[model samples]
Target: MLQKADQVPAVVAEFIGLELDDAAMARVIEYCSRDYMSSHPHQFDDHVLRQKRESVWQLPPDGTASKAIRFSAKLSLSPALRARLDEVWADTVQKRLGFESYAAFRRSLPNSLGVTRVD
Candidate 1:
């Protein structure tokens, strides 16, 4: 999807059998962009998930609450954990998604959209 971000609006429109005008298509594309979605995490129910986590954990609302979803350049993963994750991704996603490896999939995206390089 990230590979053809510009076509997403038209694809979605066709899937839903709706013919969106240029302006509406533009709006849909803008709203679906990574920048817009990351900026407006509430639209993805991040706030609700945070609230639920806080309630379950008895965390103070005014305290330093960790985000339910985060977009950042920082990544801290131990070598063992990273290896495990790679293995899991290979077993579950790589073949299904037609990627040789997670690294290859990450490289295929524009601007490394959701990826945080370890080094």
Candidate 2:
């Protein structure tokens, strides 16, 4: 599974007006936050796994130690959903990833989006 921090840095960088780079990418992998205690309303007594910090849905298909894409069959995000994505997911990603600025990281996304922002 890909780190949520990995997904977040780029999005947050876009928020605060910054650009993503290799160094930022490295940081996302390096300084990801341990957990989201604040977001969870229910408490659990069971042991929490904090290895690479990924959702169960993101786990590798064959249980191998590799990143694999997870698919959502009913994926349909509206504008409000996208906005919420920016607020909830992106904010956490930027913070946990330890980037100096979220905006910069976001600026790097368009290049990968086939928009040709990089020149």
Candidate 3:
């Protein structure tokens, strides 16, 4: 990628949010692409996972540490479910396999929809 960085450096630099040269961009891509952790949608980062989990469900107690242990709490199965809900389920299952719990999954979801239930 470095050898051909001129082709997509801007997009990569923007996404990674670092002013990178071709060599740096190439290195970043290689680092992110080779690992299953980096390959995950949330990139398997703890802060993001915690935030997402909270968004999907209830917040952690006020005193909980930033690295609060993740746990899935029951959510009322709201009838106002969104389309392609199984995709959400699939994402959760995949996330739990190596990333986070159900609550964390909901928390990771975008916007207030994270707190909403599909099933």
Best by TM-score: 1
* TM-score between candidate 1 and the true structure: 0.47
1-118 per-residue lDDT for model 3 (tens digits): 3233343445546667868776876666565442433355344445665677787788873323332224436675545463345467658775566433456565665542123444
lDDT measured at residue 53 in model 2 versus the true structure, 0 to 100: 38
- The alpha-carbon deviation from the true structure for residue 75 of candidate 2, after best TM-score superposition, in angstroms, is 28
Q: What does the lDDT come to for candidate 1?
A: 0.71
Model 1, span 1-119: residue lDDT tens: 55667776776678789998889889988887777766875675556767888899998765433332445466789999989988988888886897877677867766423335432
Best by lDDT: 1
| Model 2 Cα shift for residue 22 (angstroms) | 1.4
lDDT tens digits, residues 5-118, model 2? 456666666778987688876666445433332233123222244234345547543332322223325567899987887787557876787543456666654443233232
Candidate 2, position 20, lDDT: 60
The whole-model lDDT of each prediction reads: 0.71, 0.50, 0.51
Stretches of model 2 off by over 4 angstroms after superposition: 1-3, 33-119
Report backbone clashes per prediction.
Answer: 0, 13, 10
TM-score of each: 0.47, 0.24, 0.24
Clashes of 3: 10
